[model samples]
Target: MESSLVLEKYAEKNRFYREITEKILSGKTLNFEEALRLYQEGDFYFLGTLANVVKENLHQKRYYYTINRHINYTNVCTTNCKFCGYHKKPGEKGGYTYQVEEIIETLKSTPELKEVHIVGGVNPELPYEYYVELIRKVRENFPSLRIRAFTCVEIDWLSKISKKPVEEVLTELKQAGLNSLPGGGAEVFSERLHKELYPKKIGYQRWLEIAKTAHRLGIPTNATLLFGHLETDEEIINHLLTLREAQEETKGFYCFIPLAFIPEGNELSYLPGPSALKILKTIAISRIILSNFPHIKAYWVFLGVKLAQIALLWGADHFHGTVIEEKISQSMRKDTVVHLSKEEIERLIQEIGGEPVEI
Candidate 1:
């Protein structure tokens, strides 16, 4: 009876996107051509309505969040990603690296932190032990804490420095209590953007390879795409489809996060950022395309709390976390607010008629 009611509601609500909406409701995966049509031609409300159908179908009313602290252990980096405003040279005035003790002390001082999000610039000066011991010490200090740390780019860098395979590096980290891999460092995957935006970092294929390798090793990972920069609609579609193909094979990705590129302090500062409508459309399209992905996060750090709240209606089920000190987004120094406490985050979710879920 409940299923019939949902089906009737879906049928009535999706008239604007009847063809594609029917296909989605029938549990058929959309093809690339159809996805392109939705991007080029679908109504914003229709697309969002379709996406919300999928979201509620998968997760019901439970919107997920976590009590996590972002620990950017170092600002000293070697890569020259043009979109990055966070990395600094070793001798730069603001460059800093936290000792293991400092990280543990920060965690100890903070209360009810369920997860620790750790990412940093690719600093060659830090020894292999620095990376290994960081995870070990954190695990020792907080045995129950979930550590969602490192990007594929960072993992590739570690593989280079430790002279080990990506699998080995991930294995050691997992043994040291690494819970999962965060999806950062995956900007747009176009070759043109690669040349202009992040020539130094590994390309999309290598990033995908690293992610698949991690999944094969039983390490759950998240995937992301940074949009609203110098990428065409086709390139954005290509990025989503590529991740969808990956998820089909491994079934390891936990969530898909669409990061809006903030061009305030970076080399791309001259370009305009994505509008709120475009952000919402991107979220909706991501949900429509990456059907295999179980979650979509509207990262409140990049998207302000208000916009992130709006994203829940569009299709996003996750709102990142409390993010005590989100340095990467903060480093941009844009006109963006940073960090929301658990209470505040809950209130924001409730205001949108969403049930804030923690796990």
Candidate 2:
């Protein structure tokens, strides 16, 4: 069918769809109601088309990946959030914490590494100095590598344990060679979800505060939303809008990643995870709503390689890097591959008619 015929049919069937399409193409912003309606009732194909237009307008045909590795320094956590499958209680049988030298040794083995993502559970056993020393040692060993470490949740825990303010903790870490913060721990922005799902972690207000503080200190960060769980459509839209408003203020978010919930080994194992349509719809909606976000990522670790390829056409511009190893998702699913070679990544992007650019 011709593109014109499709538009005509849609326009005749749904006037609001045509109106919103024109509104988006005219370079106008989507308000809360418009974005929410699109998320709830918009046609799947048309939604992807509109989101792809927005993506191309911002990033052209370029898709980005990075040569990075993830370091799960420790799994012993006290928080024990219900949705997490990676955390182990202190002194649990499988728990481990890497010494600073051990982390350096792991980094030394990876070739062509550009970034090291360091995140772990909220382990009460480790002293505050250990966190600083880890960053310092990573910087000492790999001076040129970008060190994206910690989430707002971990930072809040550090502040409490060290008897320092959040700003002070961030400043100390920055001085010790932290480049930026990752966008985990922001499960959703609703207070109801915060209390229901991750009451032990920091709430949304504190997360935003810590993120904006990092931005003010010249550290850029990414933002994320964990969907396909117990969240409603309104909660999802509100989460994106909150991030959009925060981005308007600080301009610090590097990317927005919509993480699909994997309900394998967690407490929510009874529930089925998000379907392919929901995943693609969420990605497209994220790109449409988060206009200030420079990139939208199709994190293959959660979405899988093939579906992630389809996501590239539906609004995502970043295929999250050659993560040498990621333990969080691996703990939940035994089939999760820990590494993807740069060649494999580029081939996957190119096969989908995308130009792979390594950042």
Candidate 3:
């Protein structure tokens, strides 16, 4: 459909969206039914306008990016989820795990880094002490760097290995200086897909419980959805709504990152990935639907830099930092660079007329 005709045609047929738009413009919140209706009936331009209204009201022209780095401590994992192309078995030809000293050395080499985003495979061989010591050592060395490490999946695995409850494990990690939760290991929330992809991993409800526990203990976290692969629109809406309800309850989710499933080295590589339009639509709809969620991030690493810049206007307020080294995506598709410089990220934000915000 033509962009100009989308709003006009919908305005004539459906009074619902028009009414919702008025509410949105008037700074009123849309209820669940209204949001679901918008997802079903709202046109591209209409959704974009409503989303932009929210984005501008919250942040104006200023977009957020981070001066950070990503460190994948180990690629060895036991779960072996079908959608993953990065995990390797222990003692496998390509598997590697970084020691605490090695991680500290790497952190020392990189200066002016605001955050260190760390995630790795759920390797059972790595002792629980390794993770705790890693966080303690990093925090001890760099008191200022925000350590956003581990996913709910890792936490679940940690609890199992350490024979501790989820809350107890989280408490120990927080005591050892774990700052926040990185959004990973949450591929989708649909039960059917969840089992097919990651049967051995923790269930969706378990993931949410772990997150809620972290929130209760004062650890803020980012939420994510891996879309564009065997999931339906209803499943997507359900996933978003689930996160929305959780956010409303705990107020711990800081951002919602929509991950476009990259089909390359995974078992689902036979399927095609999402299109650019779908990606933008997901980003824009996220802003409109997740009303309580404060920020939506357009991760340049997964979506690519150019598409990420375009997503800023599509209602994404956060650009994931200068990921100095990203391995998970590269493992799937080995054609891209492993790191992006801070200046390059700033220039990309500037080109889109967004103020580069670093924190």
TM-score of 3: 0.94
After best superposition, candidate 2 residue 62: deviation in angstroms? 0.2
Report the lDDT tens digits of candidate 3 across residue range 1-359: 53335545656777886687667667666666777777767677788866776787888888887878889999999887888899998888999999889999999999898999999988977999999999999999999889999999999999999999989998988898899998787778889988888898888898999999999999998899999888887778888888988998999999899999999999999989999988988888888778788899998888988898888888899988888898999999887566778788888889977788887
Candidate that scores best on TM-score = 2
lDDT of each: 0.88, 0.92, 0.86
Question: Which residue segments of model 2 deviate by more than 4 Å?
Answer: 1-13
Clashing pairs in 2: none
lDDT of 2 by residue, 236-287 (tens): 9999999999999999999999999999889988889899999999999999
In order of appearance, the predictions have TM-scores of: 0.95, 0.97, 0.94
> Which candidate leads in lDDT?
2
Indicate the residue-level lDDT of 25 in model 2: 71
Flag regions of model 1 displaced more than 4 Å.
1-16
Please provide, for model 1 over 1-359, each residue's C-alpha lDDT reduced to its tens digit, 9 standing for 90 to 100: 34335445645766635667678877887777889888877777667877887898899887999998999999999887888899998788999999989999999988998999999989988987788899999999899999999999999999999999999999999999898999987888788888887888999889989999999999999999999988889998999998988898999999999999888888989999999988999999999888789999989889888899999988899988888887888889655676678889899889878899987
Residue 127 of model 1, lDDT score: 87
Cα RMSD, model 2: 1.6
